[model samples]
Target chain A: MLDKTLIGRESESTLVEVERGAIRRLADAVGDANPVHTDEAAARSAGFASLAAPLTFPGVLAQNERFRHSLDLGTRSLLLGEASIEYGRPIVAGDRLTVKTKVADVQERAGTSGATDVLILETEGRGAEGEFVFRTRETYILRRG
Target chain B: MLLARQLYFEAVKVGDELPPLVKPPVDRSQVARFCGATGDYGPLHVDEPFARNAGFPSVLVPGMLAMGFLGELVTDWLRGARVRRFGARFVKIVWPGDVVTVRGRVADRRFEAGGRYAVDIEVWGENQRGELVVRGAVTAQLFYSGDDETRQRGGQPPLVVTPAEEEERLAKLSRSTAPARPAVGTRPAAAPAKVQPAKPAAVPQKGAPPVPVQAKVPPRPEPKPVAKPAPKAPVKKAPAKKAPAPKSVPKKAAPKTKAGKRR
Candidate 1:
């Protein structure tokens, strides 16, 4: 089981920025053909200052990949289970994002199989405006290695 | 917002493959453009001035770039299908000079769609280092020709494709909209020329900031001799052989042939 003391602990910040070609390429890959994603003119017509990808686009920025090491996965014994995201608004291109992930909960249980610790990580994706665009809840399970 | 209503049940099979994509490597220019378009000007992205003080040798690519890449991987392979749901963990940091590949294999098929097929697939990405960068799993609905009356209307697209029978439809559509891509792969995507400067995406805008002097661009390269049309691999330029930073606009056309065997 993970140390209960590790709960509510935060990891270093990782950031990322949005790129246009990649957005266009992603649009192409999905065959979305959405002008709002590829054509700046279409973007202006729709009211955005420039072409921006969908709200889910924020899922890409690591605050621009500033994260050098991850403390969560490096721990002595753990199993990454699942991850999910709930958004506030769309992440546009040119947006710089910073991610501050924290271990939110820790619980241990012993079943017929064995014993394990379920660790939940809460990551808040912030932009320059300090707006928290996304609040993600990720769960990890730690058992004897 | 509800971007697009995707596939129904009855169309997916266990072995279908989504269209494949090669994500361009991470580099300096890609970082700059991404920051510009998204308006994400966090100093960590482009401010080398501060990034140095904050602790790092240079700028890095965002994890969002990889997420966008995964979204594209699913959308492209469906060839017009919509991605109703998907998710991933940014397993590794992507940087310049690394080759990236994305592939999705149909994993299951469900029939909850009144008659349509709710196709499920697992998407994955890998880098030149043989590292798993992002793993995405998505569910989409496909049209198999007997299912619906609306499939003809581009079937309420994730972004309606106009469903032409041939690639020529898209080729013809390009004639009037986007400028013809000039370099293709012949001009090394990132290889910058010592004397001749290339076009920058920001040039069209008047008040754009002058490109930082420290920005490095790959040297302009000689074309490969292979005669075959370049593979569908994106024009992500190779950054080796040059210490220059990535330029703001290094978009190159598709190469004539596969650039040496991509790992």
Candidate 2:
């Protein structure tokens, strides 16, 4: 059984520097040919101060070690059920964001195969000035035998 | 194309379909590049042996990658519109050689508090076989062509507009619809200067309800995070204040019972 006590556990804050190259690489890997993601001049022309990260770019920040281990999954087979991100502002290259995560909830529900325990995690990224930038909520299903 | 063409708030309709983006076949190299880019080096996505042990014929594609595809679909269609929210639910595993096609439709649109127009989009990705692999939504804030000048000036539009202008804009928006008809009829026939202050009150009573109804469509996933924290706040405080004494007692008793069972 998944531990309900893991709810509310928080990860130590990690600092992530949003790099221009990283944004370009992710956009390329996803086959998005939007030039604003790769060219600073194009981004500026599009009214952005710098290269704007893709809408799902925060998914990378959520993969840090501290955030991943905040809730111990043990040896359970894990599958991502849902992922959601809400942005307060567009993340741009050269912005340093402080990222922190917390286990929001855990519940067991009947699954297509059998009973499954759902783990909900919420992560927030704040800019250097402590302004909210984005938040991502990920739901993981831990299958039980 | 860099900026392509700008999308305006007034030009979009609720049922408009976004041009679908069909990706080439998923190959190992592409998945590997995605893994390196995102730093999600999960073994299930890269190691064929590990994937077989986990009960899959081949390595599975990362759900985040599928989400990224959907994100591209929305951003490309919206052009320069600012994405306020993007989310997805993984319905089935995607594997190498599967072609994913992303599609979206304009689900709703409304004027937000900041004097910006926002649109809600329903987006999804399906395999070549037409099975849904991921489904999601995107909420983006769009700009009117004239709003560029407002932004360059660094000022927001006034919170309240004159009743006549408000009514005219609403009528223009709903000229083809039914609910807005009644609100248009309520427009005061008196001179604009005379009814300016008094009519402002009536406009909101008629116009405000529908805006909220439209706003409610996109916030379905928000209530869980908003409501979960409230109950947790008290639980956190209670544990800090009085939990240690009781919790320690259980800790002490638990080991004793374990030792008794061992004997």
Which lDDT values do the candidates have, in the order given?
0.47, 0.66
lDDT of model 1, residue B33: 69
Q: What is the DockQ of each candidate?
A: 0.09, 0.30
Please report how far candidate 1 places residue B254 from its true position, in Å: 21
RMSD of 2: 17.5
RMSD of each: 16.7, 17.5
Q: Put down candidate 1 lDDT per residue, A67-95, tens digits, no spaces.
A: 31344434233223344555544455776
The fraction of reference interface contacts (C-alpha pairs within 8 A across chains A and B) present in each candidate is 0.07, 0.66
Which has the greatest TM-score? Answer: 2
Compose the digit string of candidate 2's lDDT tens values, residues A23-102.
98899888888778998887776667799898889988887655565556765555676789999888899999999988
Q: B147-253, model 2: which lDDT tens digit per residue?
A: 44345347655243343565587688688776653331122223333312122223223321211100112323322222121111111111111111101111111
